[model samples]
Target chain A: MKVILVGFGVIGKGVVKVIDKKKNHLKSKYGLDLKIVAICDRSGAAIDENGLDLKTALKVKEETGKISNYPEKGKNMSIVDVIKTVDADAIVEATPTNIETGEPAKTHMIEAFKNGKHVITANKGPLALYFNELTSYAEKYNKIFRYEASVGGAMPIINLAKETLAGNEITEIKGILNGTTNYILTKMEKEKLDFDTVLKEAQELGIAETNPHQDISGLDTAAKIVILANSIMNKNVSIKDVKLEGITRITPEALTMANKSGYTIKLIGEVSENKLEVGPKLIPIDDPMNVKGSLNVAMLNTDLAKEVVVVGRGAGDIETSSAILSDIISVYLRTKNE
Target chain B: MKNNKKQKYNNFNKTLYYYGENMITLDLELKDIPGELIRALTPISNMGVNIFSVIHLREKKTDGRVPVRVVISDAGNRLNEVINKLEEMDIIITKVNETTRKTDIDIVVVGHVVDTDVRDTIDRLNKYGLVVDLDLSMPDPFKESSARMKVIIETDKLDDLCKELDKISEEKNLLFIKSF
Candidate 1:
């Protein structure tokens, strides 16, 4: 199976590593000759009728962190050119989201589906911004459209909630979905470190980007929860559906007061009974969510289960990419079965 | 890094797999008592199919009952055998995923794969220039003694990483799942 890749960022590169590593395993396990045949980004796109060399591609991505130089490395063609040309079996849309406009990536995904290719994504902005329209096109085309890596990175919460918990109606879903806010909150609680110190550490660690408002203010969590809401609940929800709050102005006094009262603060994403909301809250000490530092993520208070907390390294090229691989394996398994 | 190292793998080769198929969920409406879920899951565990995911609880306070959803992964031929056993045990079969695909993948890494030697590991990754996104650490409640010591790689690693770990596993007591 030929795979066209988009958004050759950290997660995209991770997908390349695991896919290259497990190429044979995937083939033997699922009868899939999975090949990443194309890639697209803001700068440019790369496509090859023959399989793309993932290792070399990662080097180019690192050297310039852009897809502009792939043809410079003497590949066949540009990524967008391939999206228009390649008869790929699957499309991996990993492009960065322009939340304001939901551009380029969204256009690329629709084109893939229109051309009858399966679509998988790590981009949330488009989906969060326009899930209803895109999903309808996917269903209309009868293609496999999955986004496991979008919300929780590596946690199998989306699949677990969708397929595993398909029996009972999903009554509620909640978690410390954003690592940036959780990092700051965890630092405030443990070492008397203020939000500023934690934010600095997070940026250095890549958990929080340089401009971390989306992650810090809980908008990221809100966006993610709305997506999960639609997937698990099979309903349409928008940004307005999500009530958002940021931890921007949280004071040490507030943190100290929460600590004094035996509570810890966290930016939590929550969805229940079709009512979706996300924000920072003071969770009690006894809450199963006393999860501190960077390792905090959980699906809480399901009518069918109290909580299925999957805690781990939330970010990393490989770790988040692990979710992509899991989805790829799933797509391979499904595709091969046909 | 897709490193195919000079290491051996004692892997479970050539296991006949059933194509996409539904795994049964033995849903039960039991009282929200102390040992309800454990009683259900423990028996299923004994029966052999790996529990992929499980959930059970009573939502409505008005009605005191629990709904359980258990997703399992296993080969067929034994599929009927497992279902028969669950039925014999009076396990109420609930929702079933008609045709689900489960990948044969597990993550096993050196427990302290990046402990004191964080820089070395980062350097290794940097060779491939794989961006490390979300590698921040949490405060260990039990922050024990430290050395540049590598702990056992037990649970999960990318397939290529598995081959590399197999080479150094013997020297480092890497508790990898499938290393020769």
Candidate 2:
């Protein structure tokens, strides 16, 4: 399978490393030989018709800070240009999310579908805003679109609900989808520190971004839930439809009070029939949803199965890349016969 | 066949019937003090209700109260009477059968809890639910103070209580962190 990587950030670099590490395993286990035809960054794109050397691509990105610096195969080309002219079977869109306007990534996926190529992205912006529009384009062009890594990082959700639990009617989806907020809240409760103090410590440790507005303000979780609602539950909703409430006002005294009542506070994003909300919900201390630290946990309420809970690390370059790689192989197996 | 008999017990001399074969459960919250458990169960016994099992949820004891689940048989039509008698004795009945009749909701209010007329805030919330327990901490009067309150309300009125909290939040510039 020939693939194009649309972003060369941390996640993109991880994708290259994973593909290189799993090259032999993929060939031996599934008889699948994958190749990277193009890797695009802000500077330009690195293209190779036959296949790009995975090591050299990473080295160019690390040393020169741009994939376009690859020996002689690199060129100054736009992502759209590469997607439209590149001869590839699929394009892994790992661009950074723009929640306000699902731009760039949105256009990238649309162009990939129009140019007769499959798309496997970990981008949440386009899916949150233009989910139906993007999916329609994929369907209109008769292409396969997969984005399992968009939500819950390495934790399997979109595919697990839509595939493994196929027969059960998924009634609702709820969990701690963001790891940064979970980390801050956990540290606050454990250390008896104020929200600002704990958040500062987290930002120093790189668990939180310098500008952690999206993660702490519940916008990130809202976007991810919107995707799950639209794709897995077949609901036509966007981020605006979510009733959002962040954990800005939570205090250590509040956690103590909640502990007295056998409960803990978590930024829970819940989507169900006639309800789409993201806020600090009281989870029973011993409940499956009360996972500590920077771990993400989700509970899918199904009609037949009753309830299913999945817990995993919600962030990390390689952890998220693991999900993207799985989607890549899935696309391969599905379209291999064709 | 069993005979239904009228019995007079206690100082009130209220006529109670010892009859029927219905089994029911009462989730009662008792003060963590001596004789409170026996005091809660005596009312049902006075109504000629036979006690089946009493399970003490010791692990769930919070705020100086212990939850006791009492199962009784032979109450039948006297179930309401037993509930009324318990209420008359100031015993908190949290649930009847598997249905939650009353629930305790804990909320942490941040902002000028005392400056914004905390009494009025409690009074307004009391319209929908009883604000039974309150704990306030003010690290500095110039800064926002946080208050934790436990409101015992009927399960059906939860939505109304939340709506009231939102209204209070908007009116007084207070943030209510609620446990639902």
Q: Where does model 1 sit among the CAPRI classes?
A: incorrect
Name the lDDT of candidate 1. Answer: 0.65
lDDT tens per residue, model 1, B1-180: 233332222122211231135445544444467886777677667867688677654442112445666767753577667666665764544334543221112112323444535465445433322322212222352331111111222123333443454445444442232211
Which candidate leads the pack in DockQ?
2
Error of 1 at A98 (Å): 2.0
C-alpha local distance difference test of each model: 0.65, 0.91
lDDT per residue for candidate 2 within A108-158, as digits (tens), equals 999999999999999999999999999999999999999999999999999
Candidate 1 lDDT, A1-338, residue by residue in tens: 78888777767788889888888887787777888877766677666668878887888888877766875434435555677777788888877766666777788788888888888888888888888888888989888898888887777788878777677667777788877687787777677765688788878977789998778767778778888888887778887778666776454545554554345667778888745777666566667766776765766456666567666656667877888877877887787757
Best by lDDT: 2
Each model's chain A TM-score: 0.91, 0.99
For candidate 2, lDDT tens digit of each residue in B49-95?
88978999998887888999998885767888999999999888999
Q: Candidate 1 has what TM-score?
A: 0.62
Q: Score the docking of each candidate (DockQ).
A: 0.01, 0.35
The residue ranges of model 1 lying beyond 4 angstroms of the native Cα positions read A64-80, B1-180
